[model samples]
Structure formats: C-alpha cells, structure tokens
Target chain A: MSMQDTASSGVALWRLVADGIERGIADGRFAAGDKLPGEMEIAETYRVNRHTVRRALAALAERGIVRAERGSGTYVEAQKLAYPLRSRTRFSEIVGAEGREPHGRMIEASEDVATRELARELGLKTGAPLVRIEAIRLADRTPICVSTTWLSAELFPGAGTVFAATRSMTKMLEHYGIRDYRRGATRITAGIVDATDAARLDLPLGRPILVVDATDLDLEGKPLVTKHSRFAAERVEFLVEP
Target chain B: MSMQDTASSGVALWRLVADGIERGIADGRFAAGDKLPGEMEIAETYRVNRHTVRRALAALAERGIVRAERGSGTYVEAQKLAYPLRSRTRFSEIVGAEGREPHGRMIEASEDVATRELARELGLKTGAPLVRIEAIRLADRTPICVSTTWLSAELFPGAGTVFAATRSMTKMLEHYGIRDYRRGATRITAGIVDATDAARLDLPLGRPILVVDATDLDLEGKPLVTKHSRFAAERVEFLVEP
Candidate 1:
C-alpha cells in the first residue's frame, strides 16, 4: 500500500515517487498550500537520488498537484477538502471531520424585498421582505466560501441578529424553534471570482469559484432558506454519494 | 414572469434589465461564448434607453456573468450546462436534454499495464493488463470534456474498438454483456486547464476545469470501469439531486 512498494514493478522510480507524493496529497499527509519537504528529505524518504526526486516534483507540477515558486520550495496547489452534500449535512461537522476548524464571519446582513428570482426560489411572493445574511466561511483560518442566504423576514425576523451572534446557520435556525432542516436541491456551477468575492476569499483574481445554488427545507418540506454560496474551487472537492 | 413585468416593482430599471438578461443566460436564451446583441437591440427588447442598457451590461460584466470585448460588444461568459450525476447518468443524454448535440472522439486507445493508482481504482493487481480509452466529448461541436477511462483488459477485451464504433460508453458496455451499470462515488474538484486539455477543449490557458473522478459499478456492485473526466468548468454544472 505504500508508494515505495510499487517501485518493484516496471514503472519508473521517478513515477513511483511522484505517485507516492500524489497519494500523500490525496490522503492529506501534505496539506494544500503547505511547502513540500526539501528534495534531500524526499530522496531520503524514497531511498532515491535527488535527481529522481527532482523529476518526480516536476511531474507533480505538470499535473498541477503542486507548484514551484522561483525562490520558495514546492507547495501543494490547493486544499481539496471533501465536501459532501446530503440531507442532514452540517458545515461544522464536515470541516471537523477533515480535522480543520470551521469559522463563519458575518460580512453584512439586512432585511430587503425579495427580487423576482429570489422570490421564486424561496416560494415567496414577489416583493416579500426577506432577511439577507452574507458571510464568509473559513477552514482553519483559510477563507474558502462566501455565501449569501435569504429567508422569509416574516418567519425569521431576528435571523440576522441570531446569525451575527452565533456565527452558525444551524444554530441560528435552532433559535427560531426549528431544529431540523434538510438540503433540497443543489446546483453546482463554476465561474471566475469577482472582485468582491476575491477580496473576501483572499483569492487572486481569475481563480475559479464553485457557485452553489441550494435550498434548505424544514421538517414539513417548506422551503426555509435559499442560499447562494461561492466556494474557492481549488480548496474543496465535492463528494457525491449515491 | 418576464423581466419587463418586474419593472412595476420598486427596483431600478437598469437592475431589472440586468436581471432579465441574466435570466436569459440561465435559460439558454443566450449560450456560453455567444456575443450579446447591440445596445440598440437590447434597449428595444427591454423598452429602455441605450444608456440604461449600457449600465445593465456593465453590471453583468462586473458580476462575471458576461464579458465585454473591445469593439465587439459583450459575450456571455460561459455555458452552464446542467449535468446530473446520478445512478444512471449518460453524457449524450444529458447534453441532448439541454437541446445540444453530443459528440465523442477517441483521441487514443491502447492496452497498458495498470499503474498502482489505476490498479487500486479498478480493484486489480498492480501490473494487470487494462484498456485505456482517452476521449474528447463535445456539445454542439463545442468541446466540453476530456476523459480517460480504464477497464480490466481480461474482463472486457477490445473495449476501445467497441467504444470507437459506438462512441458511447453505454453501448460499449452492452457489447460486453453489461445491460446495466450504475454510478458509484464521484469526487469533483477544480483546477486550471493544462496546455493539452486547453487545446482539446478549445479553451484559453488558465481557465478552470472540473476534475471528476468516478467509478461505474455493475449490477452485482462490482467495479466495472474507472473514469477521470475533466470538464470545462464554465460550460457545465453538476446537479446533485437527493
């Protein structure tokens, strides 16, 4: 099961080393944005020469598993957090399972009239007042997602105050006497990060972001909230289970 | 409801125009990479002035929904094709459901010994012979995905030939007496396109690509084939339905 064990096969030593490093990445031995070990260290670990380690690093770079800076050592490209979308999915639990601390910061919150699209999504009439909560979510202090969530203002009158106080959606919903909600439909698209999101996410311009348009429903199947989330694409991977 | 009908609401006219145009993009009235009509035309359609239309377009540009090309008007940024990843998802059917033609081309097909990663994915011993199929898929002649698939060579011999003849994975499986197969786990990540895929997908360098690592399972719940597909992130979206 080790990368070195596969070297006995006909595959090149460099490839095996590269594959091993990649496996390390996939399994989280090497975190994204973390500087890779020095070439001498890798060579020693793999029982290979520095030249072979160099070749392996090059291959990894070509595949975008890692990137090399002119002066800095090689670093894993981005975090690939396993994010699962399920009925009872909880953001805090998901990040916790990955051994990372999850933090949410409220950027802005307001009560506004729902736009036509928002009304249709939340099953509210046009011009109905809604509470809009904008927040940035971070995994272990690394900003990863910026989301805007809208709920019926009439139903969740103090939603903004609750969210700002708790910094947790699930907790905020609990304060509304609703303890159970499930994911409805999730639509995942991608786009280049806009300026505002780039600043919020601390991502460079032109980086791709995964746009998630999702709905949450209460125990009675009534739409509870409509959320628009933009995830730093490189930092997370969605795991879809049947 | 039409965008013009929403004008009666308190929202500004320019904002209404922008929302309408965005809706048009979402509903496929305008496709990815398609240039927008002239300002005069858009104004006429929305019953607005040229200045109002210009402001709307600018808003769209700021949101990354569309990009303005110098002297050539504005263009819809990219197509957002809805791709559902289900127990029985098919590429051609998904594309066709979106009112676009689906085409597949075999870039290369060969018999190769499975590497460690490939062996683990296909549940085979390292060095086991396997058939590798590399293909590019398109929607209405717009390249969208490039995938590499691996099957146990001993179990399904000449899979490449069947695939070349049918241009369909479902059909290829049929030739191997697999009347039905379902999707297993799917991992979705995003990265910038490399040079080879950029050319194959007719995309510019640095554009984001969705990396989908998936498995096909036979009726008996055995792994059949493993697929690695890279999609033009802007052209397609994955719909995960509960």
Candidate 2:
C-alpha cells in the first residue's frame, strides 16, 4: 500500500496491474493456458510491491484467468476447439483446422416421430415419422461433441445403410437423390450438460455447453438437416467468419 | 445391491432403466434442464429397485445427460451445438443466422504492413501493409465477440474510413468499388481465455473460448479479409450446410 506512482486516487495499485494483464489478454499478447511470471518477478518488472502484485494476480484468479496451485505458480486454463465465427465451415472441418482429426461415431440411426422442435425445422406435421441420427464427434479419441439430426423419412428411405457404408450423411442424402443443399439459418444458445449426455460425452453434468440448432436447405429451400449439437464448453468451439 | 427380480440380473435392471432415460434424452423427451423423477418414483415407474434407479442415474451423469443436485433431484444437461467443419460464410452473416443484430466497436483501423500470417493470406511480402481493423463485436447489447480484420492496403486506399461508417466492413469495401469475395480455408482452435481478453469481454479468465482464423479472396483471387476472432463460449455458434 505504500508504493505510489501517479494516478493515486486510491484506485488500488493492484487494480492497475490487473488492468494491464486484461489488455494483454484482449490483444492476444498472451494466449490461453499460458503462465504468468512469478509474483516477485512481476513486482520487480512493474516496479510495485510484491503484495500489490499478489493482489493483481488474485483478481485474475477470481476472474478464472489463472489457476493457482498452492505451492506452484498460477497457470492458464486449457482451451477447447473453437468454431469459426465468420466463415462457412463445417464442424468436422473446424476440428481439423485446430490440428485434430475429426471423427464421428454414429450412435443411433432410426426412424421416429417429429417432436415440436423437429416439426418446426422440418416443416412437417407434429408426430410425423422422421429419421433421427444421434452421433458423437470425437477428437483424438476424446468425445467432445454430441449431435442429433432429424430428417424427413419420407424424403429418404434406407439412408441408414448408406450412412453406415461411408459415414457421410451428406453423401448418403445425395445417394437417395436429395443432393443440393444450400446453407440456411441457425438458432444458438448456451445450456448446461445433463445426465445422459454427460455419460455419453463423459462430461460432468451441470457443465455449460454450446447449443447450435441448425436447419439445412436444398436448392429449392427445402429443409435437409435439422441437427442439435451439444458441445463441451472446455473442449469445443464455434467460429465466426468476416 | 441385493434387490433384483429372480429372472433378471441386478445389472440388467439398471441397464434397462438407464436405457429408458437415455432414450428420453436422445429422443428429446426430457429436454435439457428438465428435472427427472426421483429414485423412488422412477423405480416404481420402471418396475425396478431404487438401487437400480440410482445406478441408472449415476450412469447418466457419467454420460453428461443428467445432473443430480442434493435436495433438488436430477436435471438434463443443456443441448449440444454443432459448428461446421468446412470453410464458408462471413462473420456478420453467421451471427445474423443466430437471430441477433451484430455490431462492432472499432478499435484500430490503419494501413500497415501485413505480418507473416497476413502476408501468406494476401500472397504479399512480409512487410506489405494491409488495412487492419480491430473491433469488439457485440450481440444485442452484451459484449461477447472480438475480431480483427486485415485487408490488403494496396487494394484499397481509404479503407480506414471503413470504420467511421456503421456499415459492415465487407460492405465498406464494396462501396469503395470492390465487390465479391470467395472464402478460402480457415483455422479453428479452442483454448483457455487469456487474462486480458477475459477482462475485455467481461468473461472470467481461464474459461474456454473459441477462436476462428481465416483468410478471404476476391474474384481475381486477390486477398480481401484475413480475420481472427475470439468468442465467449456462451455467446457464439457456427452452422454446417451439409
């Protein structure tokens, strides 16, 4: 508290240091999972008291930027695979962009009646039988994403066999003659993981996950794929293109 | 552990109950965040022991399907989101599909030499200056996404003025007599939030954030926009056309 520089309006010296660290984060000078220098080192570098540096680092810990190990120094949290926010990239492709091979396991492929949400996406009557495919996408043998796709059964029969052969739902649709697909709109939200998904994805339930609800369309604007994907917050990402 | 029907093994009863609930989760019968029945009630309903019910619930938790809170029972985890794996679309349009008005806070807009990454994207020299615009994008009023775009300054002279107008960056380019852009490949990654970015976006540092890195080109195959975006996990998504 004795150390004083310029802006001494009682804003707290530690806070100023914390602000600088925050800027570093926003500007990408420091990346995720990176470790900061030791408290004594930071104090010397910033010309501040060691306690003040501790206070700044403490602030960071509260904000979840740094993880404090009692005897050891703090560490940045591990990051997940991100989705491109500004591009037209597929989930499988984004995973590869992150340098991880993308592999999807088809958990269940069956016909079921459309529920309220599926009906809206498919533009089908409620309770209409539809083909539902539940698949889990993995990276390095770790399950990171879970998806459920509902398709109009009337549009494609025996899609299961085709999908089983090549593992490309898109190609299977083409084999059944519904080839053209233009991108469509999506609905997005954040939700916590629940019991069953936690088991399948091997995640702790109550963990927050990204929810992307999307509908694909044909050249004629016909609905093609209506899928709901649950991604582990710490494991996956969505990118935006500009 | 001792409770079971004579004909069926104890483990079988648990599996059956687990399957029933798993089916509900897969079928969307028990939506994310929906509370599940109590062990007693589930046992009565599924015709199994309470121990069987507990085992089933435990299994679900392991799969990230449900979370049980003491005195509050179990609830479904949030639904998963699916981001695309391919390269396509623009950033503004991607968020637009999420049904939100997207806007940005212009941070830096200047014509400077492209760095190594930008040079590779624009097929220019390492020191070749590009029109770089940095902004923090907001969804509605909440501060969420951050993006930086680099456009070849050689192609556009007064590109700095693009930030002055509220017009979209790409549109601003079009107004300057440049039109049409074809997207190229993009890189996506998921990592922990750096202390700096976590502060700017008002996110807790060390939390998982999504990132998308990509370059764009025009009809003549001249590079247009090289964008890198960092997104908070809860506020972003990507769509797959296929």
Candidate 3:
C-alpha cells in the first residue's frame, strides 16, 4: 500500500480496498485498537463488495492487527513494544543480550568536512573537518541494520583504522583520550526502505522500515558522532525500559 | 516503494529505486557519511539504467541522505538527531517537555478471553479474561502513532467504561488505586505496513511502518498489560532514554 504508483494491476477489488484501509491506520486516522465498522458498513464505506470487505478484514486478521469473534465481530489488535526513550543503549549490547550474535563490519570510513547539520550535532562549524565511519551490523551472518558515525575529524583522524581493528567504538575512543562520551540527545522515526537497504536486508523492494537517528556527546559537550540507523522491522527489536 | 503488491500506474521506476536506497540507510547498511558505489556501479548492480540510478541517487541527495560531489561521487548522509538513550522516559511526559501537545483518544474498549500470546505477556492462562483498549495519541493534532493495551479483566472490570469516558486507559488505571505502573520490558522493530495498519495510519498500502511491542507491570511484579503500537514511517519516533 505504500506504493506511490497507481493501482493499475488486475488485483482484486478487495485487495485495493484493503490497501485503503491499511493506509488509514498507518496515517493515524483509524488508530490503534480502533474497531473497524461491520461488513455491510465497511462495504458501503469503501464502495466495495461485502465479500471484498471480508477479504480485507481477513487480511487484517492474519497480520494480528485485528481479531474477529463469531458473534462479537472484529476489533483492532492490542499490542506494543515499549522501547524506552530515556537513555541510548548500544545496538551491540542490546542485541548481544538477546542471545543474538551482534557484529559490526566496517563498510566505509573517511574524514570530511561536516555539513551544516553535522556541524550542529558536533557543535562545529559548517564545512568543519570530521571523521566518518560507516558500518553494517548484523545478527550472525544475516544483515540486519546499518550505521554511520561522524566525529570531529581532527580529533579522530585514525578512527577508521581503530574501528576496523577494534571490538567497540567506545573502547577505541577511550584509547584515543576520550574516556567517556557524555550523552547528548536522540531522535527516532519511521521510514521506508530504499533500494540499497532492501537488497542488503533481503527484504522486498520498498518495504517499510524503522529509522533511528541518534547523536552522542563528549564530556565537554562536544559531539562525538551523529549516528543514523535503519532496521528491517521483522528481524530486529529495540529492547528498552519504561 | 513500500508497495509489495506491485504498482499499476506510470510512476517512475527511479522513484522506486530511490526508495530502495533510503531503505538501505534505514537498515544501517548505508551508514551515515558512507560513500555510495559509483553511479555506474549502482546501475549495473540494480540492473536498472544509469539514468534511473542517477534519479534515485539524486532523490537521496535531496532528502539529505547523501551528498553528491561532481568529481568524487555521492556520499551518505550524516546523522541528524541527537538521540538520548540509556535511560527511561514516558511518552506523554517527554512529548510535553519537547513543547509538543500530547493527547490520547480511546478507539476501543472491551473485555475478552486472553489468547495464547496475550496470556504470555500478562502471565495469565490462555483463556483468562482480559480488558483491551486501543487509543491514538496525537502530538499537535497530527495522528503520530497508534497503540493498543491489555489488562487483566478480573483486576480492571471498569476498564471498558472508564477508558471510553476518560479517553486514557493509563489514567483510568490510576483512578483504580493503581498509583504507578512500571514497564517491565519493551521491544522495537520495523517493517512494511500490513493491510489493516496501512488503513489505520492512512498510508499507502504496504508502506513501511515501525512496530513496537511492550509489556507493563504493576507493583510486586504483577503483570499488567501487553501493548502493540504501529506507526507509519515518518509519522513519529520512539525514544529510548535521555
């Protein structure tokens, strides 16, 4: 349903109707835990056949988004993953704790001028030189997520070599006189998968995805690295507190 | 690009290609600041025309996912948000602190038998009665996300009416002499929207979505509820800690 293209296929009308219904939920109209209208009602509302409506409803049920009872009718699903937003936890730590083998492989690394946005996060100026590291972390051999980090390039000129040879970025930073990086701030959002991600994660083209944008600071309130991570939803989870 | 059902219109294939790239970053494959493969390389890799690849890459640049230097080629986007993790924060509390209005509207309230999955979260028998509530919380009238919650029916028989009236199941629990509920655990993941969620959130069918699964606990470790929230990619974000 996230398709920006038109519905031109010879797909069933119910499937199209179902697409409309799913979009409503994603867009926050129907909302979570909202009960859908009855069959006759939905059929009328969507201007589709009752059978088509039923098919849509059936699709909802299969995803565990809703449930139906013989006489009680149907209802929205009740479920959530309460990912704590209090403090940032490293993906390696959380994924490791979950008994999954979490590994990060350096995909690319370099030093470059910080753009205006990167400069803000690092408290530097636009075009300020910064060290950048990009890696793909995985559970076992299967690719799961990706991350790229930016730091004051002057402060970590040799960061790429360390990342390639080390087990932890934090550990390497410590060796480079960064005993600790104070917490700065974080941002989380959702987005769909682009071409590169779909291929790496083996997901279907244009699959929806979860994106987390995070930044860390040093003791002097200097930005260490701005990290953006994207995850294939079906494969990974954020273990959090509330 | 979130459309797994295939497109029927004359939409550009380049758009879909761009979506795929965005998907890669989300999965952490194309980490921030990482340089993409050469344009011609991407074209060959994706089996698409070079022009199509250029358009897709251009889109990423427009979204701030990457930078295109005429001579050097395109680069990955640096991190944007300063995300604070390693702590705990409440949704309503945090959203308010950000100067964003937090509102909750109950969408459904009912009592029913716990399914196998529900019983596992609430530590109850599979057939035990449970009260479920679905609500959509808006930040500034924008339907940012949706959540569904469940509680033991035996402990909260007034759930249906109180939730409907108050529009906040969390507050209603407070009225029942339940002072504070601790979140025992949370899980986060990402995926493309299913049919129903696509409808609820008003997204295109099969669009990308963020899914969160969580469980709450009362004092003395008494299981309280299991909740699931799904958000359209780009609608809202989850916080870990600050």
Q: Report the number of the highest-DockQ candidate.
A: 3
Ranking of all predicted structures according to DockQ, beginning with the best and ending with the worst:
3, 1, 2
**Docking category of candidate 2:** incorrect
Residue B138, model 1: lDDT of 95
Docking class of 1: incorrect
* Residue-by-residue lDDT tens digits, candidate 3, A11-64: 345555665666556545666777777888888876667877887778667656
Query: Which residue pairs show backbone clashes in model 1?
Result: none
User: DockQ (Cα-based) per candidate?
Assistant: 0.23, 0.10, 0.28
lDDT of 1 by residue, A1-242 (tens): 24355312223566557756865776467887989999989999888889889988886786577998877688997446789877788888999999999999999999899878889889999999999999999999888799999999999998999999999999999998988999988888776665478789976444567888899998888899999899988688888887
- What tens digits encode model 1's per-residue C-alpha lDDT throughout B50-143? 8888987887787578998888888997446889878889999999999999999899899999888788878899999999999999999888
Off by over 4 Å in 3: A1-102, A179-184, A218-222, B1-103, B219-221
Which ranges of candidate 1 are over 4 A from the true structure? A1-79, B1-79
lDDT (10s digit) by residue, model 2, range A158-185: 6666776766666777797775565577
Comparing 2 and 3 on lDDT, the stronger one: 3
Taking the tens digit of each residue's C-alpha lDDT, what string does model 2 give over B55-142?
Answer: 8788668656689999988998844233444445555665576676667677768768877757887788899868878788776665
Give the per-residue Cα lDDT of candidate 2 at A204.
Answer: 37
- The candidate 3 chain A region of ten consecutive residues with least summed lDDT is A1-10
What's the lDDT for all of these models? Answer: 0.81, 0.67, 0.67
